[model samples]
Target: MFLVTGATGNVGAEPVRGPDAPVPDGARPVLGGLDDPGTLAGARDAGVRHVVLVSGGSAALADMSDPISRSLTLSERAVRDSGMAWTLLRPRAFMSNAPRWAPRLRAGDTVRVPFPDAPAACVDPRDVAAVAARSLVGRDPRGRVHELTGPHPRDQLAVLAEMLGRDLRCVGLTDGQARAEMERTLPAEYVDAIVRPDVQEVTGRPPRTFRQWAPAHAGAFR
Candidate 1:
């Protein structure tokens, strides 16, 4: 049987619930973290032959230099050592990220965000799910790491313009500036991680440009 971890997350949830395809009956959702040894035991008990791990691209265990990084590192190790067939999905920035800009777009045509020029190949959660589904059913998918991304890459301002249906002014700020603005509104680590370039590489496809994603999600901004 196929075991799906991170089943409730953006990509994993779509395969089980999205319109494109339905997960076969009896597929197990392995809830909990990789670092938890119980997760491995549960998979074994469930008769899971194939395991798909939906890991964050930013969570590279080999590069862990901090506590947060170490957590990711340990998780990867657990999954790798689980002795079950495995397909690791490391996804970069998610297209769902656009929602963060919703309020700013709703207020006006202007979008104020940090990392204005940082480009990302933001991926659709649905696509990530599709890939995962394929991996689960394929016999040869084990021991592979698939990095998922959109079909194109673009910056936040470009995405804003598409949503606004006109040229939207962007107020760019340094990391410090962004931290100051978001400190009261969001967790500090969240703001810092959101601006990383690794998000583009994990999502392998040229992300759907903001122009493409905007019209589809216009209602959210409106």
Candidate 2:
């Protein structure tokens, strides 16, 4: 039995779940920032040998200054020290995150961004899952940190320009404005996590690109 962190994270299911959604079949999930003794004990009870932890962004920020990073770091430490085999996956910028732009895209060709110029490489969640699967069943992926992302780092505007395939308007926001709009719901560490560069060398294959991802998910914007 496997203790998948999220239905959509390392487990690789594709669906946007609100906080209230059921776990759906075949999923045993452990959310971050909570005590995991029960969950880990359950995994142990289930005879789970390998654990795949989907840590967001590239850095664990283990220093734990903030609640979000601290929680993730704590969870990773618990799993690593659990005497069970574990693989830590850190991926930057999921293309699925682009749905945050959906309302703006639906309203007009204009999109607003906090860091339109900051470098970010959109990662495909499916690829992240593949790596996790390899870690679980293929070989010993223990004691390894997989930093995953697309082939090239791109700014928000560039990604949208490529995905939209036509002229698009982009509006830049002040940090204050951006924080109010986006960070309101997101955790502080998540909103502030440093964007790590793409490390395609780990998988021995190129990371998936926005162009490749947009078509399948384009319906969200429309």
Q: What is the lDDT, from 0 to 100, of the residue 169 in candidate 1?
A: 78
How does model 1 fare in lDDT? Answer: 0.63
Give the whole-model CA lDDT for all candidates, comma-separated: 0.63, 0.64
Could you tally the backbone clashes for each prediction?
Answer: 11, 0
| Candidate No. with top TM-score | 2
On residues 146-173, what C-alpha lDDT tens digit does candidate 2 reach at each position? 7666655555555566666756777788
Candidate 2 achieves a global lDDT of 0.64
Lowest lDDT block of 10, candidate 2: 10-19
TM-score for every candidate vs. truth? Answer: 0.71, 0.72
Q: Kindly list the per-residue Cα lDDT of model 1 for residues 1-222, writing each as its tens digit.
A: 444556666666776667555766777643476678787868767786767777665455355555655666677778788877777777666777888877876687777667666555666776667667767764434787776656445665666565566777777798677667755443332444333322244334443445665666677766
Q: Residue 209: error of model 1 in Å?
A: 5.1
